[model samples]
Target: MILRDVSFAVAPGESLAIVGSSGSGKSTLLGLLAGLDVPTRGSVSLNGIDIFALDEDGRARLRGELAGFVFQSFQLLPALNALENVMLPLELAGAKDARQRAEHSLAQVGLSARSLHRPQHLSGGEQQRVALARAFVTRPRILFADEPTGNLDHATGAQVIELMLELNRAQGTTLILVTHDVALAGRCGRQLRLEAGSVVQ
Candidate 1:
């Protein structure tokens, strides 16, 4: 098993950071929390609902309705431009104003001018901004980021961190992130340290 005996709860509107060395189960724990992977012997509750009790489709619907994700790799589709990428989740949810909401989200991330650019055409920081835009456009109740700044340089990473924190505060969205950066972890209201697939701190 990649993770063992890991249990924690995040209050609404709070920020929590999961910190660990490489291979310490940080990403695995995140996957479990996001309901992308099921736990073998435990439960994950979100918004007071036990996600593991639901079937795969049920859990997926829950995620779409209540959660957002940002990854280190900036998982924007290669075929779509920034606006289309950000608009995807909203469209998937059948929102009537997806285009408008997507444009607003991109503007919030300082990507208004780059909205027409594809991920491959933008800089790393710009691409990550697009990813952030996509994550928040749904106005999700919780946001999960896995190594969100891992691919950026120091200065660019700092900018992304600031923007994420700002958005979290502004929207009152619960934030959970996994990272190796001590400074990033420090910015969070609470920190959980993991070692050997267990909470060590």
Candidate 2:
């Protein structure tokens, strides 16, 4: 296997950090682990469910049930308010009180005053906070964060990272973070190092 034979496991409620430079397949491994993509030669199981065995719709459903993600770019809909953006996944799951839950989530990320603001109206850090709120509103079993601090300045990024860690501890939610930042990765309980599309250590 050119990508290398890698085998490891994350305990329930554990946080695993993946660190590598760009093009090292850190993001690719995360995508597979989160069921956003399937591996060509290996199997990935999330919460004991084999993701590759499921069809696309099935994978989507499973992901909805178990996974959440925060990407580097802050993937929020430009037209949606902070509240609406956070409510999306919850509403998709048919939560009757999505609005209230979304409001609480936004507040947790310190964006209460900006709840009615759209992405374009917010600063980069604020928009990233919105993305974090949206990813976490569902209270997913696992969260995959790809370079979550990539867009923020040091102070803002530190606050955001603290929020994520706090949520993980309080909820016992598993976290898998892919990043090139060594300091950020060090905060995680266990670390997985990747190089050239392979797990190196």
Superpose all Cα atoms of candidate 1 onto the true structure and report the RMSD in Å to 1 decimal. 0.8
* lDDT on C-alpha atoms for all candidate structures: 0.95, 0.88
Checking candidate 2 for backbone clashes, the offending pairs are none
**Best candidate, lDDT:** 1
Mark the regions of model 2 whose C-alpha exceeds 4 Å error after superposition.
Answer: none
lDDT of 1 at 103: 99
| All candidates: TM-score | 0.98, 0.96
* lDDT of candidate 2 over 46-125, digit per residue (tens): 78888899999999999899888999899999888989999999988999999999999998889999999989999988
Candidate 1 per-residue C-alpha lDDT over 56-103 given as tens digits, one digit per residue, 9 for 90 to 100: 999999999999999999999999999999999999999999999999
